[model samples]
Target: MEKEATRKKYNISVEATLEVIGGKWKCVILCHLTHGRKRTSDLKRLMPSITQKMLTQQLRELEEDGVVNRIVYNQVPPRVEYELSEYGLSLESILNALCNWGETHIIKKYGDKYAVLEDSILNQ
Candidate 1:
């Protein structure tokens, strides 16, 4: 019974974490937030296609999940910054591996140069 309870707890934690960073945009957002704290405007600039509403929704979800922290600075205009929590940073290696794999597998297949070119000035 104790072992079963332990397994259930593990499953819940794993599933919840995956749910937080599971989506395409979520992972990218998390990766960008890892760089530093950023405002909604900054994130929009980094990912031009992401709409304001979607960005807000995603940020809200991440904050709710305890994967992100929102710092609101007191001012005439609210200066809110979003940053990753320690739990979020734990996925950095996993995200980086995905990046490397995408470069080699996805990008390489249909990159500008269809044929693999040797490193030479002529190839430039």
Candidate 2:
């Protein structure tokens, strides 16, 4: 049955985790959220490379997966913020490891050339 097949598809712990957080941007979004609550605009500003549509879609998926909490406040123009749910916060260590691995990989692969560029961008 379709349901049975679906269940089997994510039976593995890694598969289950990936089902929720695997994507070009989901991990990155989660990493940023680990810092603190951020509005959609703030996320966009931090990651200018992502399109609004893609960002909205990824956030919606994260919310649906119960990994990200979306809070809305009544105000003149309406205010909304996103933060990691307790479940999402559980990913902190994993995200940190991934970030570390990425930095190491970049340094090893590109050496000082790309590291300086990345440093300048982060500094800016």
Candidate 3:
């Protein structure tokens, strides 16, 4: 009955959480937004490696998941700002723990120049 045990009905809630924050870039996005609201261009500026299209797509997913709030202003030049929602703020502890753990020991021990670039690659 290993199959039966392992194949229990999938829970939508768990899947939903994963859907929101499961991807390689979602957490990274959350990390940056945690500080304060930021304009779309500001995000791109800070993380120049991420393409605009991908950022838009991921932000859409995050907005759908109720993890982020996108505020648009009707100015002469349209402005958009992104900030984390209450649900997204819940990840603060988990994210902080990760940061602390990494800074305290992991980075010190590993000390690889490519460590930053290799985070998602090695994890996957």
Candidate 4:
């Protein structure tokens, strides 16, 4: 007979959501993906502060969580790209809300949203 897997419980509902998307880099990575598909190099360029090892680890974790899809293409050099899975697209509104709140906070403190934020494609 096959055994059934156990279901984990969370103290707060948000905690369960955080468990999958929580982290310093996960949201940033997902934000980039929301724009379009990106390879490891593209992501590194977008997020210059993240180390190669850390980026790999975070991507792997996201892939494992079923939020990110890894697409490997067979070519001369072998190319790989990452994109948000269907389920992951559901977080778009949440991410947008966080971004709006952050802009508000920055403007409130610095008197300008762009003052503290870097000029990137996502800034638009």
Model 2: weakest 10-residue lDDT segment is 115-124
* Model 1 C-alpha lDDT per residue in residues 58-96, reported as the tens digit of each score: 999999988889999999788999998887788889878
TM-score per prediction, in order, is 0.74, 0.85, 0.73, 0.90
- What is candidate 4's lDDT per residue for 63-108, written digit by digit as tens? 9989999999989799999999998899999988887898899989
How many clashing residue pairs appear in each of the predictions shown? 0, 0, 0, 0
Q: Pick the candidate with the highest lDDT.
A: 4
Off by over 4 Å in 4: 1-6, 121-124
| Root mean square deviation (Cα) for candidate 3 | 7.8
**Clash list (residue pairs), candidate 1:** none
Decreasing TM-score order of the candidates = 4, 2, 1, 3
Predicted structure 1, TM vs. truth: 0.74
Of the candidates shown, which would achieve the greatest TM-score relative to the real structure? Answer: 4
- lDDT per residue for candidate 2 within 7-96, as digits (tens), equals 554466898888889989999899889989999998888788899999999999999989999999999799999999999999999999
How large an RMSD does model 4 have? 2.2
Count clashing residue pairs in model 2: 0
Instruction: Give each model's whole-structure lDDT.
Output: 0.77, 0.87, 0.79, 0.89
